[model samples]
Target: MFWSRKEKEHSSKKGEDFSEVIERIKSGDKKLRERFINDYRPFILGCVSKHMNRFIDIENCEEFSIGLMAFDEAISSYNSIKGGHFLSFAELVINRRLINHRKKEIKNSKVIPFSYFGGENEQIIENSISEKSIYLHYDRFEMREEIMIYNEKLEMFGITMNDLVKKSPKHKDSKELMVGIAKIIADNDNLYNKLISKKTLPMSDLIAFVTVNPKTVEKNRKYIIAVCLALKSDLEIIKGFIRKF
Candidate 1:
């Protein structure tokens, strides 16, 4: 059996629009909801593991459960038309859930001692989870500041986070290719400055310089611009996010 050209074209665009998929998932599209979970599972686990400092057992782990719930919350709360990425919002929710859980655990217990360690050491460890929660606030604060800086930087380039979220390349291979294009721009001085100064994709230059399709580059123009700026700027967290998911 063979697929028709129209069928092939329909399949091609089934999941390409990330923002549309997210909105449908929020509107109770069961298939899309499943896709959302499967798609972002690794991302959610990565956030949970980094926050918890270990790989989580999704089968029966509370932290994993919390992370899933937080991700779900992020999905419901995500505004695709707004200027923010879903993963960033999800990470913030995961951190908040973990922090609140630690607070609750600490509050419900009185003189909870760990006999494995001496009394003082156990107390220190127990208190550390609570205290560490406060320090995590600083981490979130730094991310917020970075987001503000990133937003302003993107504005200078005539783009916004909403544009990135909406126009990101559909396939991983396409995204990787775009990342390479971004690297090319980041590695060169003139191209970088031209893009920065003009707030636009140097399409002719990129088409001549980078070995990629002009149509593809233009289709993912906003995302390429954002990635180029992120790679060139001090946006560590955003860079890590792009590299990770």
Candidate 2:
């Protein structure tokens, strides 16, 4: 999704380009800069949420503040020739800042203060680096754990990530309807049990319990089951992504 320099220049014709506005901001358009940041607050929050792997409360999140600063820094440092797309660069900066902020927090939580071991400054530096590495490793480990569990669940229904990406409803109304149907099935004990045991959507029971079109249910059976599985599991990050939709 990274925009090339040519794409950034030409996309204005489609009314989806931000390069011009970014250029204006870079040229010291203070008012537009403020408005631009305000308008893109949701994008900033989304990047932070993805890193945190949960829903965020914008009013209280320190990470969100860091994201905003990082985005502002991106606008200041961004180079169309070298940065690809402004947003892509901004997200990279935001994630890097958030990671560094997290590492500092981890370092602060050490059992003894660095000042306590006056001549052991080198040891403290080594421990900090080690902890940062472990933090990153554990973060990847947790995400992998969730993905493995989700993949296993999808396999039970004979669905792949490719299937979901390709078959997921393109229309907003259709997507909402599918999510609603999935929620219903996930909430009902009998329907959920039947789906788990059968390893397929219980269409008849779902239709009987709800007033949805049977053919629609059948058409999106895999997607419906996938959503239901997400709802039934403890995969907070997966659930967070679904909430965005």
Candidate 3:
């Protein structure tokens, strides 16, 4: 069920008008800024997580960061002269930023399709069903070993293979952009070293060197960092997985 009548009343705090609260917040009230953030913590976080359709660890979560920033943006950017409720404006800001963040991450991600390593069928010389089964088993074994090693490498970044599965960008255009960014990182020695030595992305340097923005770099930090690690190393097996993508 949606929030009950009582819940709405509690959220309103003595039936104070929502727009009035925004006006007070906008009037250079430092205490209200902190108080409003504190009061609406659940609302902001809940909006983001609900939009993302996942359990958000708002504590240090990227979505949380983006959402709170969007809220701040809404406060500064809102205009009653144009005429709209504060929450409506805030929701629009939150939704747009969340979508922008996702799109940025998708573009920034350098995807290596793990499916390349697996063999489907080849119509081998062996015609019997049993023989085909044997070949399939061997191929399956090879794919499993490759996946295991890939997962192990991902562990260094605190991401599991499962996480990649959930995080894969569906759009081909996004995937292409990610691959292009990965190529830039793979070719540049300084970029590669920062990814390896610092364990963080050189987003500013990359933006200066490549055609990407801070939002893109920040969104896809984990995926880009992981792919750089794979590409820079002697992980030929993992590199092989990247060939088709």
Best by lDDT: 2
Query: Candidate 2 deviates by what RMSD?
Result: 16.7
lDDT of 2 by residue, 1-245 (tens): 34456644665454354667778889998877786687679889998887776678999988899999999998887754221346655766787687678667667774323332235364546433455555765467556656766776687678999999998998999999899888898789898888887888877777787787888788888899899888876556688877876
Model 1 C-alpha lDDT per residue in residues 85-195, reported as the tens digit of each score: 556656777776776775566567523233222344554565334435544654685578578668866886678888887888888988888888888888887887788
Could you tell me the lDDT of residue 219 within candidate 3?
Answer: 69
TM-score of model number 2: 0.47
lDDT by residue (1-245, candidate 3, tens digit) is 24446545755675344665567778887776676766677879887876655677776688888999898888877754333345655655776676566545444553322222223332333322343444454345445544544555566567776666666556777666776677788788787667655557777678877666678767666666566655654334577776667
Q: Write down the TM-score of every candidate.
A: 0.47, 0.47, 0.42
Clashing pairs in 3: none
What is the lDDT ranking, best to worst?
A: 2, 1, 3
Task: Report the C-alpha displacement of residue 183, candidate 1, in angstroms.
Answer: 0.7
| lDDT of predicted model 1 | 0.70
